[model samples]
Target: MKEKVVAINRVAKVVKGGRRFSFSAIVVVGDGNGTVGYGLGKANEVTDAIAKGIDDAKKNLVKVPLYKHTVPHVMEGKYSGGFVLVQPAAAGTGVIAGGAMRAVFESAGIKDVLAKSKGSSNPHNVVKATFDALLKMRDPMQIAQQRGITLSQVFNG
Candidate 1:
């Protein structure tokens, strides 16, 4: 399968009595050419949390716009309190990102991409919003059909 569970992190919440620990997971799944999915899970155990997150991600797989080996355009989205920006890049550019963002791209089989994450740094929100944005993407074939035009007319014309 092309899908992968990229990273799992232990998170803690401060409470009145003590610290409450939980596991946060980021799962990325893709077919490399264009489709990718990212998911987050929070639970008492790291394995269970990651497994749940991956399952959710698979259930929510999305197809993103791809031009050559990179994204077709730049886009942004917000989830919870995090903002994510995804941009296409030329070949050999590689993925210029860190943290959960990088893992998302890698699992999605993206070799070259540019990304920026802002606002809340929560991994779950960031990953989820990114997936949301990607899921909204439109491919040339779909666009041509929607516009009632040929692919060449829509792109080359």
Candidate 2:
């Protein structure tokens, strides 16, 4: 799996003599297919924190349905103060996104998509919101089933 570090933060705690410092990392992992996951880890060192994040990400892997190397439909998601709108794009459109939202799409193996991240730009919140949108996507087959129609009928109608 490929892993990308979305954010690394240094946290300090006040102590009697001095301050205790630690690191926190947010990571995204993917197999370059349709499986992706995100993780957060904390440790005394950046490397350790990243390692933990990768392991955690593996534990949370999820499969996304891809249609022609793009999202099946428009999607919107929100988490805390972050909101994201995701839409499918043509094959050559490429990934039109930025910052943490870009990382999430790349990790999810989506090659063509149009995304806009609104509200808070916080990487943590953006990542979660992106996942929320991705997880909410449904395949055409599922939609057809839900509508109690044959797959061909869905397309014909």
Candidate 3:
């Protein structure tokens, strides 16, 4: 009762034999504690597809470190011929992203984010690239520690 599924889609492929149909699932799972995950799955059936996607997503879950209600920095990421740009915005900025990108941000518990997708209109690749960007995100604390400098000095520098 604590899990939520966002969407499911049917994808098709035509071969010599006939038309082959598969399902694609986009799932948003979160605890509302600044943790969320997005997954994509394809299968012969909707339920199986969703189950597969959810399982895979859980297994690949990455914690996105948040600053207040937004990301810690701006980052760009690419995957499977898709490109995504993610920007941190001031509070109340709201989510300004396309459908695919929106699902990724919303599931990640981000309240305010700005995103742009390019190179590919395929939702799967776009969302995956966005998640990759989120996974690469680093907070100030981590940066300061890695640089062996105090937080104040790091910020000032």
Number of the predicted model whose lDDT against the real structure is largest: 2
Better of 2 and 3 by lDDT: 2
Q: Per-residue error at 88 for model 3, in Å?
A: 0.8
Off by over 4 Å in 3: 1-9, 12-20
Q: Which 10-residue window of candidate 3 scores lowest in summed lDDT?
A: 1-10
- C-alpha displacement of 91 in model 3, angstroms? 0.6
lDDT of 3 at 3: 42
Q: TM-score of every model?
A: 0.75, 0.95, 0.84
What is the lDDT of every predicted structure here? Answer: 0.77, 0.93, 0.81
Residue-pair clashes per prediction, in order, are 0, 0, 0
Tens-digit lDDT track of model 3 for 87-128: 999999999998877876777778898889989978778877
Residue 72 displacement in candidate 3 (angstroms): 0.9
Instruction: Give the alpha carbon lDDT tens digit for every residue of 47-79 in model 2.
Output: 999999999999999998888899999999999
List the candidate numbers ranked by TM-score, top first.
Answer: 2, 3, 1
Clashing pairs in 2: none
- Provide the lowest-lDDT 10-residue window in model 1: 1-10
